[model samples]
Target chain A: MKRFIGFIRKEFYHIFRDRRSLFILFGMPIAQILLFGFAITNEINNVNIAILDHSKDTSTLEIINKISNSKYFSIKQIISREAEIESVFQKGKIKAVLNFEKDFGRNLIKKKSAQIQIITDATDPNTANSITNYINAILQNYLQEKNKSIQLDYQIIPQTRMVYNQELKSVFLFVPGVMTIILMLVSAMMTSISITREKELGTMEILLVSPLKPFQVIIGKVVPYIFLSIINAAVIVLLSIFIFKMPVEGSLILLGAESVLFIITSLALGILISTISDTQQSAMMISLMGLMLPVILLSGFIFPISSMPAPLQVISNIIPAKWFIIIIKGIMLKGVGLAFVWKETLILIGMTVFFIAVSVKKYKIRLD
Target chain B: MKNENVIEVENLTKAFGAFKAVNAISFEVKKGEIFGFLGANGAGKTTAIKMLIGISHPTSGKAKVVDFDVYTQPEAIKRNIGYMSQRFALYDDLTVQENINFFGGIYGLSRKAIRQKSKDSLVELGMHEISSKLVGSLPLGWKQKLSFSVALLHEPKIVFLDEPTGGVDPITRRQFWEMIYKAADQGTTIFVTTHYMDEAEYCDRVSIMVEGKIEALDTPKNLKQQFKVASMNEVFLKLARNIE
Candidate 1:
């Protein structure tokens, strides 16, 4: 136990002495949370769009005023002819164009329907889709306001309520994913790199020849990373709660325990990576490419799993981060306890055990 | 248990499929003997040393290190032996004192003992002033000597040095031999491998390996006389060339 403690103390020394790695371990979590919370957001605001109104009537003007008044759209240009619409779109600032047909007000009153074309630039499909949807919502609101007195005999309105994130705040979605990613990267990458560094420095040979058991050495390398990654988890949680005003509805202690488990899972992966790789560069590359890309893309962190193709959804099930994201979301957002997240918790524990077992089996006892 | 031979091997061999890296070679080292294991690079000097140190398994062998079977009691063998490889083994990022303490602690030394030994070793190396300096910043010779000292920190029964003086200056190499002699004087068996023929002279007994086989084994004077050469280098060349 003293030897293990000494080894861990030495690992801590290595971590603390390297300023760059220290920064990577502690600095990245807060920075990523802030960046994801504030900078890289999916929320649309002040989108530049052009207008083409042929009728120049009060109804068309009123619709245009309503669109511009909402924070979502800003009318950048008004075109007289349809020919100019393509040219304005080619200039590329305008993401959409609202085309009001000729005699729209008269047609609406006489035929009880009129054409209002929401022509959005499909170059950026997501924003274009959002722009089209926002215009449709605005038009629907206008119609509802105008038809307030004309009640239909049977009307069914779909009332939707966002359960966990009531405001639909993007930060609420990002904080959990960011925290998961930071914990994974820091725990897996740091432990793998530290282990491979011993191999690179040839200290592994001395260590292997020493009295220290191979598992003791591996665990010693991983313990410090677990401690640091937990601190990172805490930093991300604190940043999300304090800076972003995110809520933790479940037991904070349960959240902490789950984070530690995930951290161990990542650290086990790190030991496995170090077992296979011989150099620090390869260890780092394997961890970043092998772990990070999947956690980011396939874990449903950014993309919703339900919307993903069938095979990708199946693949996402294998990614531990997906389960972690689900677990934490259940905890922080849904305020569920272990009974709700026990299945995910079991999967994570199983993966952690498998990784540690594989690494132990793969860990070299001889320099063959 | 009171046997004079600290290391005993018979028909020890390590083969990778059909290629024998260390052929069926047999040897014995008396306690406190400085046994020089010499060979050309890739001649299995390292492979044999690794097997004896319990870091490499032998394909077919019978070996006893400190009365522990190489195959059955490698863990016990590991605890009773010290190893210094050609590669620099100390952590460069760690301070001088920290490396010593860590390795010392790895060998199950107590905290107070590690501190005392670290101070004494640093002072013996005349590096007490730079005990706080990172080992990476030290020169190559100093690093080699420091690693040797660190390897012996546990005071194991046998110390294995695999080409420990590969890149050191001649003066440092001389100092290294002196340290080996000093350790042997204190009744520690030294099993060392090297390519430098000049270093072969310092060993109490020497073995020349050529293509995984021990072509010759004797004291330096006896080897030179047996090969009808005036120097250990000529003896090695004669044996190596004849085998080739």
Candidate 2:
């Protein structure tokens, strides 16, 4: 027990003495949460738009005033000619244009129909789609209010409610994914680099020849990283809660337990990577390229796995982060219990065991 | 089978898929003797040492190190023996005192004993003032000596030095040999491998290996007389030239 404690102390010293790694260990989580929460958002606000009103009548003016009053759109310019619309779009500041056709009020009152064109910049297709949808929703609400007294022949209303995140806050989606990524990168990448450093420095031979068992050495090297990654997980969660007002509706103890399990899964992957790599550079490269990219891109962190092609969705099942993200989202957002996320939790546990078993087998084979 | 011998081997071999790295060979070393293991680059010196140190298992062989069988009692062998690799294995990021403390602790020494020993060893080397310095900042000669001292910290029965003095100045090499002799004098057996023929002259007995086989084993004077040469260097050349 004393020996193990000494080994852990040495590992702590190694981590604390390196200033750059220390910064990365503690600083990355808070920075990523803030960046993802505030900067990279899908919610639309104060989008610059132009209105081309050919009729210049009370009805067109009323619709224009309604659009401009909403928080989603800001009228930047009143385009006079059709030529001015293209020029304004070319300036790149205007996100969309609202054009009312000639005699729109007459058509609306007499024929109960009118034409309005919502031309949006499709270069950024996601924002363009969102902008068009928001405008359509606003127009539909206006039409309902204007036609409340008139009885229509057929009317179908679709009522929708967002269950987990009522506000559709993008931060709710990012906090869990970012937390998983941070934990994975810190635990797996750091441990692999540290193990391969000993190999490169030739200190691994001395360690192998020592009285310490191979398993003890590996466990000793990994324990410190587990502590560090857990602390980072806590910091990320707290920041998300305090700064972004994201809620953790489930039991905090279960959340902590799940985070630690994911941390262990990542550490086991680190051990496997170190066994395959002989140098720190190769270990780092393998962890980043083979692990990080897939976790970020294919684990439904940034892009939904269901929307991906069939094969990619199938491939995403192998990424451990996919299960973790689902588990975290279920617990934090949906306020679900173990009964809800037990399958994902079991999958994570199974993967952790498999990774550790394979790494141990590889390490034993290497000793001979 | 003699009780006086610390290391014994008979027909020891290691094969990597039909390519035999260390072919069948046999030798013995008495306790407290400086046995010099000399070989060419691919002559399997490292492979043999690895098996004897209990890091690598032999394919077919009978070997005993420090009264423990290599196949059955690798843990016992590891506990009873010490090894200094060619790279002078020491953690560069650790302080000099921390390295000693770590190795001593793993060897099951108590905290108070490690502190005392660390102080004594540093004082002996006249490096007590720099015990807190990072090992990476130390000079090559100081690091090599520190590594040797750490390997001997547990007072193991046998110490294996694999090319301990590969790239050092002659003065440092001489000092290193002086330390080796001091250890041997105190009843710790020294099994060393080296590429320098001059270092061969310092050993109590030397063996020359060529193509995974020991071609000659004798005192330096006898080897010179048998090969009809003036020095161990010429003797090594004569034996190397005769390889078919």
TM-score of chain B of 1: 0.97
lDDT of 2 by residue, A65-88 (tens): 888999989999998889898899
**Estimated TM-score for each candidate:** 0.93, 0.95
Find the 10 residues in a row with the least total lDDT in model 2 chain A: A153-162
The sequence of per-residue lDDT tens digits that candidate 2 reaches over residues B95-175 is 999999999998888989888888887898888999999998998989998999999998998999999997888999998
**DockQ of predicted candidate 1:** 0.80
- Model 1 over residues A183-261: C-alpha lDDT tens digits? 9899899889999999998889899889888778888988888878888888888888998888899999999999999
Interface RMSD of every predicted model, in angstroms: 1.1, 0.9
Per-prediction backbone clash count:
0, 0
A253 in model 2: Cα distance from truth in Å?
Answer: 1.5
DockQ of each: 0.80, 0.82
Return the TM-score for candidate 2, rounded to 2 decimals. 0.95
